[model samples]
Target: MEHALFDDLVQSLKEARAIAHGQMPASRRIKVTAPDAKAVREQIGLSQSEFAQLMRVSVKTLQNWEQGRRHPTGPAAALLRIVQSAPDVVRKTLHA
Candidate 1:
């Protein structure tokens, strides 16, 4: 039993090393596009203030996103994508 455990550990270590050195390629990759805040707002038919309120961001931040002066990151970016894809769902969910 101990020998089998050691063998498994060694195999795991070897696989980890191979992955660390890029000898093994990852199995999958996901590509995500960032949402365009201005376009999303327009599509949803919301003004800047309304959109900013819905997004829970300041007006300045929304302006920056609209003008391409700055970009959203992390959860904000994810939420924007969701909002872009389904504005009604997002609106109902958020308002609820």
Candidate 2:
């Protein structure tokens, strides 16, 4: 590895350690909010089973998201955002 790149990685590790220890503040913070599953399903006029099928998830998984027992992460979370913002497009593309 290049000397400069190695030094940067070491610095990053130190910074991460300091942040974890609460000795230093993060340079930036990002907050992601999950969409409400039930609301999105209702807005799309789909029942739980239909919505679960459309989302490619089991009804229990959908229920967990709706009931706040579990939260969707990664791609599922992104899909929920897309569905919330553009229900018609998703319904036309995925439901049809």
Candidate 3:
């Protein structure tokens, strides 16, 4: 078979293996640091929705983070800590 066709077949098999494990096809991830959702928003003069947009997360996720309906994990928790330290940095980075 042509090299291009062989490569495509290999890629397809990788995808099929991932689907068999019930995972979405993989890709890169973004890293974000956040602050206390409520405190960070208040500090930056934004509401939950605004903050969510700035952070590229959903409003519901922000609300859940604030209300303790859900917890921020991994990089999210780290972001919250970063925000707690310097909310201005968080704001700037949000738009950046």
Candidate 4:
């Protein structure tokens, strides 16, 4: 049983190496377009300070995003996408 488990582990590692080296094609690729932070803010009719406050980011960070000097990632990026898709829903949810 122990030998079987080791064999399975070795097979898994080999598959992983193949995938890493592009010997195996990935099943699918997900493409996520980063939101246009400045456009989102303008569409919502919020000033930079207000938008920054609502997004829970520092003004400088928001400015960076707006200016394309930096990009938002992780949860912040996710939230911005949500806002872009459903501005009213996000506004109601956040303001509520």
lDDT ranking, high to low: 2, 4, 1, 3
Displacement of residue 46 (Cα, Å) in model 4 is: 0.6
Candidate 4 structure quality by residue, lDDT tens digits, 1-96: 699999999998998899899999866766566699999999889999999988989999999999999999878998999988898998888889
Best by lDDT: 2
Q: Candidate 2: misplaced stretches above 4 Å?
A: 1-32
Per-residue CA lDDT of candidate 2, range 1-96, in tens?
A: 999999999999999999999999999986556799999999889999999998999999999999999999878888899999998888789967
Ten-residue region with minimum lDDT total, candidate 1: 25-34
lDDT of 1 by residue, 12-54 (tens): 8898888889999756656566788899899989999999999
In the range 1-96, model 3's lDDT, one tens digit per residue, is 999999999998988889778786556565555456787778778877787887677999988999978878887778777777787877787777
CA lDDT, candidate 1, residue 95: 99
TM-score of 4: 0.66
Which residue runs does candidate 3 get wrong by more than 4 Å?
1-35
* TM-score list, all predictions: 0.67, 0.65, 0.55, 0.66
| Top model number, TM-score | 1
Report the candidate with higher lDDT, 2 versus 3: 2
**Candidate 3 — worst ten consecutive residues by lDDT sum?**
26-35
Q: Every model's Cα RMSD, please?
A: 4.7, 3.5, 6.3, 4.5
Which pairs clash in the backbone of model 2? none
Worst 10 residues of 2 by lDDT: 29-38
